[model samples]
Target chain A: MTRKAFITESDVRALAADLIAAGTRVVAPGRVGTPLGERIEYRVANKVDEILLGQDEPARSLKDFFLPPTDVILAWQEKKDQVELTPVSSTFAPQVIIGAKPCDAAALEIVDKVMDWDYHDELWFGRRAATTIITLACEGGDRSCFCTAVGLEPSGTRGSDVLLTPAAGGYSAEILTDKGEKLVAAHAVRFGADKGADEARAFAEKGRKRVDANLGLKPAEVRKWLAGHFDDAFWKSIALACHGCGACASVCPTCHCFDIVDECEGLGCGVRRRNWDTCQTAKFTMHGSGHNPRADQSSRMRQRVMHKFCIYPERFGEILCTGCGRCARVCPGGMDILEVVSKVNEMACGGAK
Target chain B: MAETKILAFVCNWCSYGGADNAGGMRLKYPADVRLVRVMCSGRIDPVFIIKAFERGADGVIVSGCHPGDCHYTAGNYHARRRFAVFRELMIFMGIDPRRVTFSWVSASEGGKWRDVVSETVERVRALGPFEGYRGLTGRQHG
Candidate 1:
């Protein structure tokens, strides 16, 4: 038998307090005072008023919580015979990330393959392992959402421990995994049996249909077309307007390219840092001896497209794009990925010869 | 005319072999093209390309295997895709995309190797020295 419960609006605050009292760090969206009124911010849940569960999505991504813009990876001191490398603390407290959308959770899974394969990244994995994600199905889809195109439903539970669907004046919580079950059991009294799970499911289906209508391409077909058209002129034509500002790459849920650098001062003490990098930048692939293989805009654009649709799937059996539509929204030139993928497919069918 | 400095990135499998073939035939191409061999064309990072221009290279040429003829099977394909995008980005930054060239050169194509070097040298000569990046970085031209 599966356990299901309804968490009413009034009980949300108490439930948040319970999670905090249980020694788990709870992160949820809140409003922070900025120069221009209050801006949505992710904050540690100390009070129930700090949690915002009904919003479409945060203005910024949840990636900053795991991979900060700048982190001290190493600290070293010069010694007589050898360099003394100070070990950074690996201790991380378990955390609960509430109100993540299904597409955001799915994006983490896509990132996990790149961060885990060949070289296991402890920084990213440690944070991921310590976090249990609770995803909320969008009652109404936003224009910037297209999760359905990338093999995700608005209500999909691909990367969540628990999935919550909106119900009449309450939320129907489904324990998707053992971890979620344990979490619910810790605060069982606050939740009651939800007999309206069937109705919530119907509401979620209606939301998924709106998402599907916005996504213009099926991911599998896009991947197939990209695999074959390695030398098409379509890349140059579409990518000509790209400024290489890296806004699209930075906002994208699955763009995970990074660069490692060692920094030092006059004292010979230094730290090695890994920072987010984008192929959209011209300096991403230059060699030490003054040679560059990827020295063109069309080539760089093709790389971004192929990395998302072709190479990633061939390596991980999953596409790197979650179709969060953040890239399209953030690109200065309005470089819509859906339009690019559509053109790729059209060319594959001999329409753009 | 002063000799133009050109950086040639030769992929380990094909273009490097093509360079060797040029040497074996004693085919006199411009000595201006300096060769830097890499494991695969795909492994060539775009940062190095920008660095070459910063260091006062008149031009840069990236030669790999004919699309599907890479020793690593699909290395050139990856290179092609990457370079196409990087080239566009450079152009948007006001760097002439012609300063960077991508061509499919096979190991047996010694004549093609000569042609690539001569053509790149002539083109860079017409463009004069690469002075745009030097002004921004405040570095002396070579």
Candidate 2:
């Protein structure tokens, strides 16, 4: 049977301390100060007070826990004119993520389709298997958010092992997957039978309404319009001020493009590493022979939109974006993706020929 | 093509030799061009030209030997077909086709090489520097 329980704010903290005491790494949304000032980041938490759960989405997504920004795949050594490659281990240690945003969690399930499409990414799945994600119903996003338009709500539990909704004194813990059940059972005293129904119900409603107030686009129409208009002049105007700094990609929940390079430390040894990359930049498609297919920012911008709205859905049966709105908030050029989608919606209506 | 910065992709056996001949004969070519030699014109991927423009090149030229005269027979033919599609696509995306010029110069035609370079330089100079995608870095003005 599925397990449902009530975890008070103090109970959640105790659970975190208990997990850490048992030598399991606990990850949560915590405040981090950057040059841009204080923003929440998904980081390791040593104490419960450090965590800021059920707030606005973290500046970064949960993808980093599964597919890190940079990872070493293999190492090589040239000994006596014979080169040998040593493979890196795919297995990782146990960890638990607390207070995940719904959009961030859903992005994992969406990207999982591609990561496992052609070839199984062993490292990606390895971390996934080793980690259990506990997601909190979101704190609500701003005008830039459009999660409801993409068929997701603030309470989405698509990828979380455990779903937590704020209640009277704490949260209503809905044990979702097998890992979540085992966790609650192993630490049975940390949770009590579900008794926070009224507060949790009201809180979930408020979150849903907050996100629903944002813009909604018909994904099917957006995809159809994008499929036929690769040469549209609308694309030229959409990216007029695009800085191509790729800050949007850097914060995107599902933008998972990466580049592999061989870094040599010395004449005898070297390592092959993969680093996150973005199509927003020209180097993403540049050829060593001095040619680039997606040459300018306009062309690159078109690819970004196409991949999210058309190519990915056609290939994977799902839209690429989760409507987290972090891209709009982070863009230096003021390129708002929601505004572009609104234009695409107007064009789809057959008025902008 | 631009008087400010013009880039050229020349085929090793022919266009490069044509440029060499012009220099050997003391022909005066425009000083705007910088040449990168590949084994054959077919080796020039469209990305090279895109990279050039992304780096602020105002004009670019891809020169090779006459189609049937390529050292590696049929290489220039492939480049011709590729550029035909790419050129139109660039125009559709608002990049002026005149900014990117394609020509065939034989090794014996040193004068033709000089003329192509001079003409490309003059045309691209008139059009001015490309600012279409410079906002991407925002540092282009710096």
Candidate 3:
């Protein structure tokens, strides 16, 4: 498709500032720690440099910015004639997320399916609708990134309003939808006409190579292997060292299992909350009558693999994993899911009948 | 021998009916399995499974409709996916995955219900007792 060099670095910052001035809240990755090696922190966009665009993915995910760790859903108060169901305070302001990678935006789209499937999650959807995401294409992907493995490319514009590709000291910004058009129109002075389209394509190709190298196996093949190997011994072997810390699932960009709880505060006053839960935790599938269905690590390991590969695809026709490699990085026991899937596939192909 | 306590989380539509069918048939299976009926297999939260273990149940079974026969069309599909992952988590925690069993039992399958209970009881009996991971406040027995 045709592309345009919308804004330079200086112009991008000016556009962000203009958006903020025009009553649109801007959120971007802010720098934390010292100059030697800095960490990224999600904060409101004010300064241009604070918005880390075209860098590697952040250590933390964009999930926290939308679905917070903990929040009150509903408040209840008892009355003489009727019981009042007071909704929690929703202070969602319309905002623009600058410098979001395409992979992260795609992950949000994947999560939205489950969250909005059976139940309408107002809290998550509220934040999503109120924000316009502008994804900056990765000039170079990191060693841990494998967004391409799960039907996404580093430069793919699957779930972004505006997709910005790096060009000659500027960005070849493609207006993806009405949202992108509106965002650009809001700060028309910063945007320029088409300039370096070929350079952006070259950068995207380099980024795609890095992404493909990280993914050793195809997602479709992994799903097929998992479908048949529900009773494999590989699950027992790899999951033996698992401490069930649930760090992998918590840090994963796609793991969206949650539990809703009601907290009572004396005379019928209470708050309902939805907290993130993980299948990697031992207590995840425990029953009320004192029976734990998945009481051991081996079975738990099997469940984790099957859920991602077999069951999720059966239901949603999509693999639950984004291949971001966060689970492999964060897992305390060095439980690499890629290695596990590969081994399982090998066993299946070898006619282990 | 101490009584084997089995906790069964049955889906309201199929598995629960199967269990009820077992009762109607007067098919004598082990009385060890206690049934807790839920709206659907999808409603069987992971917390409920953990709480059952904490409360001292020796075994837990999550029974629902067959893959394609779910009353809600795909509730069992979601449940299967959930338990698949939950099983992995349990295995990592030094827990025996055999203690938890997930099976498909439709409403008409009274015979299957008996078989499930029989198999689960036998398996739990082989595993002996679950005294390993007790709750924080629960009494620990040697």
Count of residue pairs whose backbone atoms collide, per candidate = 32, 6, 27
Q: Determine the C-alpha RMSD for candidate 1 after optimal superposition of all C-alphas.
A: 17.6
Model 2 error, position A186 (Å): 1.4
From the highest TM-score down, the ranking of the candidates is: 2, 1, 3
Alpha carbon lDDT at A72, candidate 3:
71
Residue A333 displacement in candidate 1 (angstroms):
1.7
lDDT per residue as tens, model 3, A149-181:
677888888778888888888888888877778
Query: What local lDDT does model 1 show for residue B139?
Result: 17
| Each candidate's fnat | 0.00, 0.00, 0.00
Q: Report chain B TM per candidate.
A: 0.93, 0.92, 0.92
Error of 3 at B110 (Å): 70
Pitting candidate 2 against candidate 3, the one with the higher TM-score is: 2
Give DockQ per model, in order.
Answer: 0.01, 0.01, 0.01
Task: Give the lDDT ranking, best first.
Answer: 2, 3, 1
What DockQ score does model 1 reach against the true complex? 0.01
How high is the CA lDDT of each candidate model? 0.79, 0.85, 0.79
- Cα lDDT tens digits, model 1, B1-142, are 6788889888988888888898899999778888999988998888878878866687999998998798898988888898989998998988898888788788999889988988888888888888666445321110
User: What is the per-residue lDDT of model 2 for residues A1-353, given as tens digits with 9 covering 90 to 100?
Assistant: 45678898888888888998888889999999889899889998887788776576788888888777877788899999899998888888888998888898899989989999989998888887888888898756788888888888887778888889887788898888998888888888989889776776777778778877877677889899999999989889988899888988888999999999886643577678877999998888999997999888889999999999899999999889989999999888888999998789878875676
